[model samples]
Target: MPAALHPDFLRLPVAHRAWHDRAAGRPENSRAAIRAAVAAGYAIEIDLQPSAENRPMVFHDYDLKRLTGRPGKINAFTADELAATRLIDAEDGIPSFAEVLEIVAGRVPLLVEIKDQDGAMGPDTRGFEAEVAAALGTYAGPLAVMSFNPHAVAAFHAARPDIAVGLTTSSYRPTDWVFLPAAACDALREIADYDRVGASFISHEHDDLARPRVAELKAAGAGILCWTIRSTEAEAAARMVAHNVTFEGYRALIPG
Candidate 1:
């Protein structure tokens, strides 16, 4: 049997992007948002991607237009340049992964999502995973890493076997990845390579939890988690199947 996942990770309500509320000046992955989650005693989830300087920055989009209102890719700017570009509707700018970790400071557990760089996913591809590992080298707290790409999970697991890792799954549609061939999209959607990736947990799409594979994984004791829960009904339904949730949009109705 695989190793049992830490119970603390399965019990806490994970704040997706740190309780971000743009109107409140707390943007997703911003310092203020992370602090809010910490105060609420909820675990925090953040996204990591490298800037031009190879420093891991805490952000979500590949392009800067959506959040930063800048006309360029996130990697086009150095860490300092990214930090100086203000996030819309908030005073905070893009934060370095190290800075976000410091702000959390073990106040709550963390779930780090490694964003995919275009279509690159293999271990021999970009070194974003290594950069993330290095940034997190000294973080002495409850934390786990996850990604939509199985290769990303595998790369991290190979480097830091001690740190728990997970795979994010969704029922893929052709529109989801127009560049990929149908077979490739099918493989990703089915999570067919999960066993080979050595992931300790599964952060699946809430709607996709009814799949037989998800139930089997849960019964076999792989930690069952789900993401992007935004409403009370969705949270309630997801909790019925998944052990814990990654939530955002309105306050989460935590499972009893």
Candidate 2:
């Protein structure tokens, strides 16, 4: 049998990259945004990027140019060095996964996505799974880990069997992902890796929730989670198929 997502995770809206509001000075994945998500009583979603030391950092991009305005790969820096670097708008530093756990302190459920280190989403996982398992050893929280790469998810599940694992699915629209070759997208579109990776859930692209494969997964008892919802209409649409939503940009409604 596949692992399962805990019930609490489906009860509330998950803040995508935390409750980020750059105009309000809480940039995505910043400590301030995560804190705000906790205070607002929403589940928090974050991404993990490996650092120079192979430690997991709470970051979205492999490169620092966009978020930090610095011109190097995030992995080029050690944990301390990355933490010292500030996000452009908020002046908050890039925090490690360990630091994020401290900030969240298990206040709400966490949804963590492990960024693919190798561009191919291939089998070379860089031991990030084991590294994250080590970091999460002491965190007694309601959380789950997922990745776009099946290999990474499988690796993580092996190392941390107690934690739930899932796949971050996509519609595999070619224009949307220029870097991913069309063949790769086509292969991933079918979600053939779902069972192989022991994934019990999938966080799929919001616009593609109506995909037949998504419904099939749900019927097979897989949890259905949706991503990057930014409007109430979209939220309602996603809720039609999703157990819950990972949202950003606007406040999401919690069910009564």
Candidate 3:
């Protein structure tokens, strides 16, 4: 039988990018943010971008400019260089997935989103999923991996079938996805690959949670989670559809 999403993931508010706060010295995916989220009693969500050596680095952007104040693509650097690169105006440098895993230490659940390696979500996505699985081997935690690219999710499930895997979905509106072709967006928007990929859940775009297909997935018993929710009101509304929320920018009350 396919693995299922763990029940603990649905019970707590997840800290988007690990409860990041730049002014507080906790940049997204930084060790400080991971520590802060663990301290706050919330499940943590993080993104992994591949470094030159295919090492999974805890980061969000494909480029290093926004986060590191540098002017190159992140994968241009090896794992060592990426690990040494510091986040803009923050004391912490980019951390490896293994380092972040050590910090969390299974204290709280972790939700990881693998940034799409295949520029257009194509099959050329390298074996980064294999690298990620190797790094996660020692982590005994309540955690799951997901990606906007269904191909990556399928690859990850193949790499570690014992672990629950999922998709990070969106409406894929053309205006918002100018980089992806309309056909690709239309195909992804339907989330038709969820079953074939062996996905157990989805962390969907919060504003798009009301989409009919999202409701259909919910009805079918997929564990529903939503992302980047920023306020109490939005959290309340999302709760009507999502089993749990991955939030940022504000404190979300833990549901009773």
Candidate 3 deviates by what RMSD? 0.9
lDDT per model vs. reference: 0.83, 0.92, 0.91
**Error of model 1, residue 216, in angstroms:** 1.4
- In TM-score terms, candidate 2 sits at 0.97
By lDDT, the candidates rank as: 2, 3, 1
For each candidate in turn, the TM-score is 0.94, 0.97, 0.98
Candidate 2 residue lDDT tens string, 1-256? 7667888789989999999999989999999999999999999999999999999999999899999999999989999999999997886699999989998998899999999977888889889999999999779888999999999999999998888999999998999879988999999999999999889899999999999999999999899999889999999888999999999988987778
lDDT of 2 at 109: 95
User: What order do you get sorting by TM-score, best first?
Assistant: 3, 2, 1
Q: Model 2: runs farther than 4 Å from truth?
A: none
Clashes of 3: 0
Compute the lDDT for candidate 3.
0.91
lDDT per residue for candidate 1 within 67-183, as digits (tens), equals 878899898899999989999987868999999888888778899999876463434438778788888877888888889888888887777777888888876677866766787
RMSD to true structure for each model, in Å? 1.8, 1.0, 0.9
lDDT of 3 by residue, 1-256 (tens): 5588878899989999998898988888889999999998999999998999899999899999998999899999998998788898578689999999999999999998999999998777799988999999868889899999999999999989988999899999999999999999999999999999998899999999989999999999999999879999999999999999989999977667
- Among residues 3 or more apart in sequence or in different chains, the pairs in candidate 1 whose N, CA or C atoms overlap within 3 Å are none
Q: What value does the lDDT take at residue 79 in candidate 1?
A: 92
